[model samples]
Target: MHDIAKVTLQNEMDLILAHKRSMRLAELAGLSLSAQTTFATAVSEVARTCLESGKVSYLILCVNTDQRDKFIVACLKNEQLNSNRSREGLEHAKKLVNKYNIFTSGTETAIELFYYIAPHFRVDLEKINEWRQLFRNEPSISPYEELKRKNEQLQDLSEKIQKSEAHYKTLTNSLPLTIFSLDVEGKLLYANEWLERYTGHTIDYLNNSQWKTIIHEEEYATFAVLLNKVITQGTATIKTQARLKNKQGDYIWHQVSLSPFRNEQGDLQYWIGFIVDIHAQKVVEETLKDNIELKNTQAKLKENQRTLEKYVDELNRSNLELQQFAFVASHDLQEPVRKLLFYSDYMVSNYSGVIDEKGLGFLSSMRSASHRMRNLIQDLLLFSQINKERLNFTDVNLNEIAQEACQDLEIAIEEKKAVINMSGFPVIAGDASMLRQLFENIIANAIKYSRPTQAPVVDITCKQNAGFVEIAFKDNGIGFDEKYIPQMFRLFQRLHDRTAVEGTGLGLAICRKIVEMHHGTIWANGQEGEGATFFVSLPLNTPGN
Candidate 1:
């Protein structure tokens, strides 16, 4: 576009021709008619001044052949043009084109008029040359036409400004936020309806410095600090949270964003900002924080519970080991006690004549004590071993076990003249060896606690109910009070004296232990000087059930 052409402005005729040439060139370069007229008039005035001053001047018209950045430049250039530069004429041309600039070198002056052509428009050098020739010989207009064009341009600009303001107001009002603008003096010159309605404040509050009253007292210092930053540092964008009093006089949480606008000279002229209600969002945030804290607490509690469970498990295991050791140690002690009884019996038999009668009586007492001590130790061992040993469960016919127990007690039965009556029974899941021992102990106990006149009649009966087999052993015995039922299964809990029973009290306790090991129950019912019935319930399934 810097390519230049010149025409001598020798007189009004030449000036007019140069102006027409500039007009036609601008038109061919795709300028609108108004732009062409405004630019051409300025050229005419400048060229006329040059001709009247008797200077060798020319009108320089340029056309850029580059399509991407195309321009058609018109200028009045040369040292003599400076003396005839129509200042008022150039000032009026400002509204006509995109913009213009003046350049001077030494004594030379060039008023460069920048006229735009569409970037994609193909440059037609041939058409441009033809138009240049045609307008070179064309006529010019008077000052009346120029004045009319200027007035029309001014009127159009005023209408555009009014429309722009209306559009801006409509856009800000349509938004859901509270939009406002602040001037350099921290005065609110404009605030949208949303801002005024939501805050219950207007421009009057800003003028009287009462705007701070709408902000929560707790946030006044914070808002003041931020406003100071906007005033001093000229920060373009800022955001902060504050509680603003609403129209109902209730404080609502809001997030305020501000952006400062600057003029062409890069001085801050206005601060455009808006307030967004964030009360609900803040509440949700707080709720989420509490939930997180609660979950963490629950997790910690679960961890503590797990640690406690492990500790309890360890304690149970240690107790079991100690019980097993006691059983083993008691079993080892039984061997010595057995030998002691055997040696005492031998001395009493062989040395009865060798020693005196008193010596024999003392030997008899020693043997009785040793026998009692051995029985006590054996009962203790059995009780401790009950929980110490692993149980292997299998189907056991309690009837068969009861029959075998009766056979084992054949001597005691005949000696006591006991009549054992056993009916048919059910098979159940349990440790077979333990069930055999349980039947033996319960039947033996029935025979042991019997009245001498009754001849110790024992009746073993069973019934199947639910998932268990209930077996009851009834005896015509000298039964104890029913109030002592709970203590009847406890070790060393004897209702009859040792001199009458001639047996340890651990027998019933061992029976209860065996029943419990099979996941079953044992109990007794009785009346004084009447009879006692011991019941055993064994599960039909595994203990886990």
Candidate 2:
């Protein structure tokens, strides 16, 4: 930490200051002027990268004595590690001086330079001050050297840009759609190979403003007006259909889309557009239009009516068989599991003297597994029944439904010392039994997953938006990650381990299906260890509407 100079990259001006400070530190380490210049250039480049990334950077110079020998070091640290190019630049600079080291701690990257100190040199205070002043007052590089360096850098940059452009050109040419770029005034700046090939024109022939001649005469005026509007307003409304002249000597239907790209200041830079040929789709659409009055065609209706009836009959038969199978399967599956659980419990109770602790534990595990299996089957049966049952919809009072659910869960609420909160509710068009089931299951889960040794709090809220009533159930329990919200309402998708939280993972799915049947929606949001909120939106309008 001794003999150190530090500066942070705050703005454009700080970049040069950082370089000059590093140069002074290098000169104080008894390096030649060439070494100092190399050090300054490397630092300036690193600073420029930090500035472009809009991150903070710190430059420091210090003395290190922990190595085999004492040395002077310059370190540049930022939130990110030195990029490959930056490291390469520093490596080349090291050839003109001593060694360089790179270290990373988490997200922070540090580059340290250990300078080659002259054998007999000790840090002279006056010399250090003079070098610092020189770096502070004058340019870090001589005019001639700087001019040569800038020219070399410019040449290398130009070559890289050209290589990148060629790579992109190859990619765009391989796509089937036409890709082109336009300036602010609607003049074409570049076009991919597909565009040139489809139009049967060379880049020079239909280049710039000349490309407009290839547009279909009927669509030219409208297309031109839209292009001008998009460029002026910077809007996505430039997406529309157009007829374009192709190499086949015919005008083909194409879907043209213009996406505006902007600079850092949010000002429009240019428009990147794609023209995709959709002539086949357009033809199919035209055919569909001719038969728009489907029911009026008596011959077509008679032909389709018989086929549709047969399909509907088969679907009804399949649904009936599926529901019957579910009922039979759940009953059959529960028997074996129930027997195992019963026998295990009986043996544990009657033969405790003959059974060891390990044997009892195994019996306990069997009981748990049997119970879990029974729950899963029951949940599956309930879900299938809800789908199969065509229940009547009525104007059900949600407040009454919520109260009934709470009453059903009174035992659990009392055990968990839970408090349920709800002021008022809405009367919405929905199936009463399904809505009651939804609230009961959600409320039961809230009490079941409450924080250990803490009283649980559940809040129910209802709101109206236009013709929809949104009911939300929020709980102060061990909530799950919001990232898994999509999976939350999916059958057999569990976020927590069964050992910790027992669930068949069908409650939310049932709720979603019920809401969807009523032409509404359901969703849940939560964060781990915080709480969860489940929303069920149902329409206020009746089913007949």
Candidate 3:
């Protein structure tokens, strides 16, 4: 096995060396000759050597001219002729002769033997020379002529590009906005014709530091900062107001926008920006604003005058009504009280011994009812008067007011076993007495309605927001439906049956009125089975006070 491996290695080496020598001889033959006679002789010699060495079985040579005006030549072979070495040798020699340009038509062997000495013989050599001369005399262009034509086309394209760029500049300069470009270092690079016209200067003058010099000194710093930022960020746009020197040498307001232009590499090469004349727009806007402000002021003055007149009329009417109501209440209520006293006195004095227990009970009930009627009339008078008066505005501590109100209703709260939870509250500017009444009414309602519950709980909490304070009173009592909420705050409006609850229904209405007068709002949220929470948001300060 080792001996066989050595023989195989030696055979491979011999084959590679033989192929290299053949390629070298082909290269030498291709360079040294151009005419067919010498070219054929060179190739035939290499073929003959290959055949004698038995390296090549069958050989064929081919040659042609490429587009580059250079020759391309190759050799081909058949390995099957290795079985008949003599035939392979003869075929290889004939194949080389067939490559001769003069011997164009023959079998491989005939052309090889004929062309070998025919070049030196008069008959074959004379004919080929005549054909070569005829072909050489024909007119034709060289490969260099084709490349020259392509270069002329490229030159024409470059001229068209330059003309298009000139047309683009003409269009850009015709715009109304002043267009300009600057390098990253704030040097003026390009300015449109409109800029020159606006500044009453030439393009050369505008391209220098003249543009910067024309910017108002007050805006220069800000403009510089923004310009630098635009370049640093690679791309940016900003609209800013600046004062620019016009042709008349007067400063005019202009709206300028600067934006960075970047190349494909994302590097900011320059900034392109525009400036528009905004003096007219700016003046119009300022005038409009001033006019609107003046109109608002005049309207407010007129409204105030009208409001004062209405208030005066309302006050006069209230005074007259109060006077009439006072007269009727004093005379009518006194007459009923006097009749009841007189009758009680008469019954006790004249029929004391004759009166039975049932008759005495009836007399007592008559007196009690009459006295309750008198108290109700007095409460009604007070309610009417409260509406007629104006609120007394001052900074009032709502927490303290709530505490005081609860103390006044302490007996009722304790007897009903009602729990009142009062928490954080804010100091609000309002009439102290009205706030007290507001708390009193809500708390009293909570206690009164909670009588049926096993453990009555009333939670009072307050929260102060940006412009108002919210005081919530939640009660676990007989709650009313949400649909009745709109009517709940109307005077004399009642949700529960009169026989079930004892109230004139004036309390909530008064609470709402007081809150509204303070420029605040009040609402109730509850379900039928659950309890109710009344939210009152009162402004910290009263309006028009």
Looking at candidate 1, the ten consecutive residues that score lowest on lDDT are 136-145
lDDT of 2 by residue, 178-212 (tens): 99887777767788988878888876676454557
Say which candidate scores most in TM-score: 1
The order of the candidates by lDDT, greatest first, is: 2, 1, 3
lDDT of 1 by residue, 1-545 (tens): 54444565666666666776677777766778887887787667666655665656667788766656666777776565544246655666655666677888877667777667773455676656665565444433656435433554577788999999999999999999988877766667788889878867678775586468788888877776555644546566878888988888999999988788888999888888888999999987877888978789889999999999999999999887868767665767788888989999888878888988888888888898898888888777766767626677777777777788888999999999899998988777777777777888888888888887779988998887888888888988988798888888888988878878777789889988888788788888988889989888888888676
Q: Cα miss at 55, model 2 (Å)?
A: 99
> RMSD for each model, in Å, please?
24.4, 27.9, 28.3
TM-score of 1: 0.44
Stretches of candidate 3 off by over 4 Å are 1-319, 326-372, 387-389, 451-453
Give the higher-TM-score candidate: 2 or 3.
Answer: 2
Tell me the deviation in Å of residue 100 in model 2: 99
Candidate 1, residue 401: the lDDT equals 78
Better of 1 and 2 by TM-score: 1
Stretches of candidate 2 exceeding 4 Å from the true structure: 1-321
